[model samples]
Target: MLDLLKTPVLALQDFCVLCGRALRNIVRRPHYFDDIFLQMDIIGFGSLPIVILTGFFSGAVIGLQMTRALQTYGATGQIGPIVAVTLVRELGPVLSSLLIAGRNASGMASEIGSMKVTEQIDAMRALGTDPIQKLITPRVIATTVTLPMLTIIADFVGLVGGFIVAYYLLNLTAGQYWTPAYQILEWNDIAQGLLKPFVFALVISLVGCFYGIRTTGGTQGVGRATTQAVVVASVWIFILNLFITRIFVNV
Candidate 1:
């Protein structure tokens, strides 16, 4: 039993250590503004189209499904509020983070893992360069900055999709849909919408870096790290979302 627990425990310890180091590097200089912006372009802009597409369809699907149930109670007009709240409070952040985890988390792991296996990281160490500062911190900062923005975009696009469905299928005027949707969102909901992605961004970047920096076994290890990074980041995103949502709901 102790043996069984050891690997996971050690991994958790390592992950926490890596996270601490990466975060600490943010305050310490050699701030790689160039690398940060480059990663932002890669992870942020690169992921944009999918985020928008996913947000739109998810909102449309929710709108379509809500129509029948809502009509039964003559609550069709409530669709806008329902969609808005769901997207803003839950789906938008979760889905956007998951998409990024699948996309950029894997990429981060693969890139860093390749560098690791190739001894490039070791060479950097020999040259007095901190790999965490150069490689991990930039990705962390970029993801933290971009994920919230992406989540916001996702939420807005999702609302638009819901509006389209409501306008056509439910015969809700733009005013009817937009007003309730706009009014129903509280500060708490907005906070949750923004906060979840920020937290998730940390998880995605850290997990990817952790798996990456620890990679061994050459090419096979790189593959393994990439897969683990995506899986772990995605799982943590959902887990954290639950806790975050619970906190907001109770607050």
Candidate 2:
């Protein structure tokens, strides 16, 4: 029983060794640049519209909620600062990471799982090609690079959404929203928020790829990998978020 438990730990350690060799191969063969660029487009550019829409609606709702909550306290003008802090510090990164994990990570697992089912991974190894260099590294780079960019864009759009609705719909002046918004959000708050997505990106890719590589059986295996990838990756993202928040708050 102890050995059965340790088997997973041993397997994970072996995976890291494989990852190091993969990274080396990736560095040596520059042709994988094509895959990297292609993934960035798929992961980054393709995700922009959805992230923006989610950000806009979330921001608008937050503004509306904050306005109502503050009105009860007769401190309605504080809505801007509260909205800004929430958007910049918490909502923006967390929401964006969860969305990306769901969107990209599950798809990644399914795609790779299908390849495994088809014996393409074995074929690549037989042909003297490093599958990780060809496949996993590009995903890792693209997701890590793209998510922070997405987070920043989401922050800006979300804040804009809040500001527009607050100033126009709620009858708060433009100055009322923008000024207090500025005052409440420190640079470090933004930085700490931004720092989180990289960890999430890594978690998503690792979990997705881990399941992808382990995929077996048949159609059922592919389906299982896809579902597990999203579920596990999202849970990991939430857990990581808690730790990150604690670190940021404490330090």
Candidate 3:
């Protein structure tokens, strides 16, 4: 019973230690520009299709649901601001983060876990390479840079998707939808949209790397770490979203 309780606490401590090392390495010399760019291409451009699809469908669905809700209030014309604010301030960052967590976090865990299991990470250390600097830092940098860019794309695509629904499906004019949406937005809303994803990217990448580097038990452990990485990252995204939202609100 005591061991069970201690397990999570120890894991959290180790994870924090890994995060600290990664951050410190990021600031130090010998930046791996090639690896960073490679990871950026893999993490950012490779994930675009899914991000686009998720954003478009999510916005369309929200538009559909919000239309019904607003109809009850005879305020269907207000769907623009409603959808805009919801997507920009909340849904865009949260949903995109969750999707990236599921996709990229699991991939990172599996890749690193495979290296650990196959002793490739050990070989790197034997050859005077720091796995944390070479493997983890580039991924962290790529994820941090790409997630915000992806969130912006998602936000734009989401708005466009909502506009399609509002203009065509709901028979609302472009002016009716876009004017109010643009009018209702504040700088704070945009800040919240952009900022939350940066925090979430850190959460996803670090959690994935932590789980991956710690993985044991050979192949089965790699699979388990991959699953755990996704689950933990997704939960952190939601938890972080609440705190970030509150902070943005208070500010």
Top TM-score model: 1
RMSD of each: 1.0, 1.9, 1.4
**Which residue pairs clash within candidate 1?**
none
> Model 3, 88: alpha-carbon shift in Å?
0.9
> 1-251 in candidate 2: lDDT tens per residue?
99888978986896687557555665676458889899999999999999999888888889888877788888878878887788778888889989999999988899989999999999988998777888888888899899999988888888888988788877889898889888888877988778998888878877787788889988999999999989998998888888888887965
Stretch of 10 with least lDDT, candidate 2: 22-31
Sort every candidate by TM-score, greatest first.
Answer: 1, 3, 2
- Count residue pairs with overlapping backbones in model 2: 0
Error of 1 at 230 (Å): 0.9
Provide backbone clash counts, one per model: 0, 0, 0
TM-score of 2: 0.92
lDDT of 3 by residue, 1-251 (tens): 99888999998899989999999999987789999999999999999999999999888888999988899998999988988899999999999999889999999999999999999999999998999999999999999999999999998899889999999988999999999999999999999999999999999999999999999999999999999999999999999899999988974
Give Cα-based local distance difference scores for all models.
0.95, 0.85, 0.93
Q: Candidate 1's residue-wise lDDT over 1-251, tens digit each? A: 99999999999998888989999999999899999999999999999999999999999998999999999999999999999999999999999999999999999999999999999999999999999999999999999999999999999999999999999988999999999999999999999999999999999999998999999999999999999999999998888988998988864
* After superposition, candidate 1 runs with Cα above 4 Å error: none
Model 2 lDDT, residue 80, Cα:
80
